[model samples]
Target: MFRGNKDEVFVRQALEQADYACGRWIASQRHFDVDPTSLLEPLAKAAVVTAVAIYVETARLSQLEVQRALAIETVAQARALIDRLHPLAFGGGWYGGRALR
Candidate 1:
């Protein structure tokens, strides 16, 4: 139970970070001369999937197997998005071999 709760919390935090990163990316698009249309779909999809995972985790806490799997999958997805968007949004350094900065 504690592990499940912890996983849920982690997933929630990851999703929140992804959301923030997406917002930053959108805001910085003009400065970066990036077409918002090119990235909006993935961002929107991530948001929707994150929301679904959150809802599922919150609504089905008792279902450990499903909750754990969904949490893992959602975190993976969020992390991947974050990894892709971090450099583009924050402009610190290269990420995943792409020189976003």
Candidate 2:
């Protein structure tokens, strides 16, 4: 779970960085008055997988490996986030891609 203020700030920073990387607008501009939690749900899911993947890769450098729990959690989180994502999130010109319609 997020640790509170400091962590929440970091989370916002991370989301801003990701927006920059993806050529997307700032969450405040695109998402407007929407709660940050709605924006973060998908990001948290991706962050979990990325974190575990990096850990696994780094562990391989030392001949170690990730535990099964991490893999299970990743899959479950992915499913939950995917289910929550609207089709619009993946489609249209909104994301700098061609519109599905």
Using lDDT, give the best candidate's number.
Answer: 1
Segments in model 1 whose C-alpha atoms lie over 4 Å from true places:
1-40, 61-101
lDDT, model 2: 0.40
RMSD of each: 14.8, 16.4
lDDT of 1: 0.45
What lDDT tens digits, residue by residue, belong to model 1 across residues 1-78?
356588779876865666546756543434324443233344444443454344345443224433333433333444
| Candidate 2 lDDT by residue in tens digits, 1-101 | 75669976987687567745452332223332344334333444444444444444543322122232133333344444333332323343334643122
What's the TM for model 2? Answer: 0.26
Candidate 1 global Cα RMSD: 14.8
